[model samples]
Target: MTAASRPKSVYPLGAKAVRILVADDHLVYRIGIRNLLGSEPGFDVVGEAADGLQAVELYRKLRPDVLLLDLRMPHKNGVEVVRAIRQEHQTARILVVTSYQTEEEVFQVLQAGAQGYVVKDVGRETLIEAIRAVNAGTRWVPPAIQKQFSDRVLRQELTAREIEVLRLLTRGLTNREIANVYGISANTVKNHLNNLMAKLDVADRTEAVSFCLARGIVKPEEI
Candidate 1:
């Protein structure tokens, strides 16, 4: 929601190198992804993008077997990028990699045709296995998100911190500003926003704010 944040198959079973495109706005994170996937035996890192716009362009040009997408990028965001890519190519196997574990975030991309939803802090096995599962035609929703899909997730309420983040977000404070207010990292601010989005069942901050306002979660004077 604020900021945060792959691969492919076969030849894993001994076929061809599974081609992949890694897309994230952070150069360091992108490089880390490349290094990890590149080290794997059958995974091939083909192309990379620093923003959602470039990601779409690169995806069109390369058409890799798998696209490792970050949820919150500058130009398009992962959800938009997923929708765009799918509109162009329906069979695109997109593995969404992000720090946001929100139900709405995960469900949004998967419903838009993402093949998998993986948290950024996942271990090597989980990451690699998720990539393989998606490439193999499985819709991978790990335990973290799978549990959130239950009835209880829908009934869940937002935390005080999440409400604070949502209020600031609607007030036009950037993630960094929110982070400063909370004395936390920008990434943590994003995580809080993501949690708010999930609890509120909204896609982005604006939607969350609107829902909150309409539902009386925040007073009009507050905004």
Candidate 2:
């Protein structure tokens, strides 16, 4: 018989199913994932969360074997949620399933304690494999994402103040305005810009903003 036609009992007897928690803002995607995983014999989606807050709450309540999380969500982004869950439960296993595949986003979530990262465009088999791997206590970042994460790690990281300046720069704010916002001098703001630009390897504020946006360092909505 074909794989799709195979019975659910095809797996070896006594194999325990992997419990999963699906967390995403979209209703349709959640349902789709539920149905897809439901069809698999060795997977059981125990709970669903519509937002990051709900995701954390559900994880606390359900304590599933694996958490399938979305990178972007309301109330708390994936990174914050991962940090929160991992803070309380160090053994938590989280797999980020997001539409975004930017190096910065992948690195941030993984650094925050997620075990794996996969884009939503992946095939069903790949997604299932990621969940199983995470459930088995293995990191599941794809080779391309791993390379991107490594590249981001090798680069000089920006300071918190520099990141704030970059966010303001994306809004077309003048150096003087940014300085006033922070109660600092425009010359001080200029120094921050110079430092950030050098670290980012960009020529000017415009290029810096573009680079940040493209790499998911600073989101467009933050501007």
Candidate 3:
């Protein structure tokens, strides 16, 4: 393709670069992100913050087109920041880049109106595409993040061990049988069952098992 036939951007010909605000607790990380995005051709790092509250304040003052946020900043955290900004400006474009992308974390931030979610390990090209996509009114997330988000929506929250126990429950396993499967004591199995019941909001073991079955939390063949 010729240079004149290259892909387009949201920016008009000879328009300003896309403004960006970055929020991270680590100064070095913040600086690195600033430089990385700043050096790009069509992007500009307009502001940077070391904490969530500062991120919110800077976003308000700068009103950048996009926000690159960290999940674990002090004061408010990335979720709270996303919530605050989207509350004030419904069209706010925010992206969360964090070291950890647990199901809960992805659910919280996306629920709070973040448009893009990615880990810090993403390549520069991927990050740039994510930022551009988000700025252009698109939602962007990695495959693994999408899977985690789907799991959060589809399944009730339970510990890994609790799910293991629940799977065994589907097979008519007694507490002792489940204990033998996991090599845990029967009391530990009982405790896991109790936690699962509470998390599933059920009254008893039978109800808990029924809830899991109804929700397809555990398949029969999986046990």
Model 3 residue runs over 4 Å out of place are: 1-13, 156-169, 172-216, 219-223
Candidate 1 lDDT (Cα, whole model)? 0.82
**lDDT to native, each model:** 0.82, 0.89, 0.86
Candidate 1, residues 64-153: lDDT per residue as tens digits?
Answer: 999999999997999999999999999999999998767677767776889889889998768888888888889888775775554334
Better of 1 and 2 by TM-score: 2
TM-score of 2: 0.67
| Tens-place lDDT digits, model 3, residues 1-223 | 4334544344466867889999999998988787676556789898889899999999999999999999998999889999999999999999898998877889999989999998998877789899999999999988877866765665656888999888888788999999998888999999999888877788988898787776667766677
lDDT of 3 at 87: 92
Report RMSD (Å) for each prediction in the order shown. Answer: 14.5, 7.8, 8.4
Pairs in steric clash, model 1: 11-15
* Model 1 TM-score relative to the real fold: 0.62
Given candidate 1, what's the lDDT at residue 41? 76
Worst ten-residue run, lDDT, model 3?
1-10
Model 1 root mean square deviation, Cα atoms: 14.5
| For model 2, the run of ten residues with the poorest summed lDDT | 1-10
How close is every model to the real structure, measured as TM-score? 0.62, 0.67, 0.68
How do these models rank on lDDT, best leading?
A: 2, 3, 1
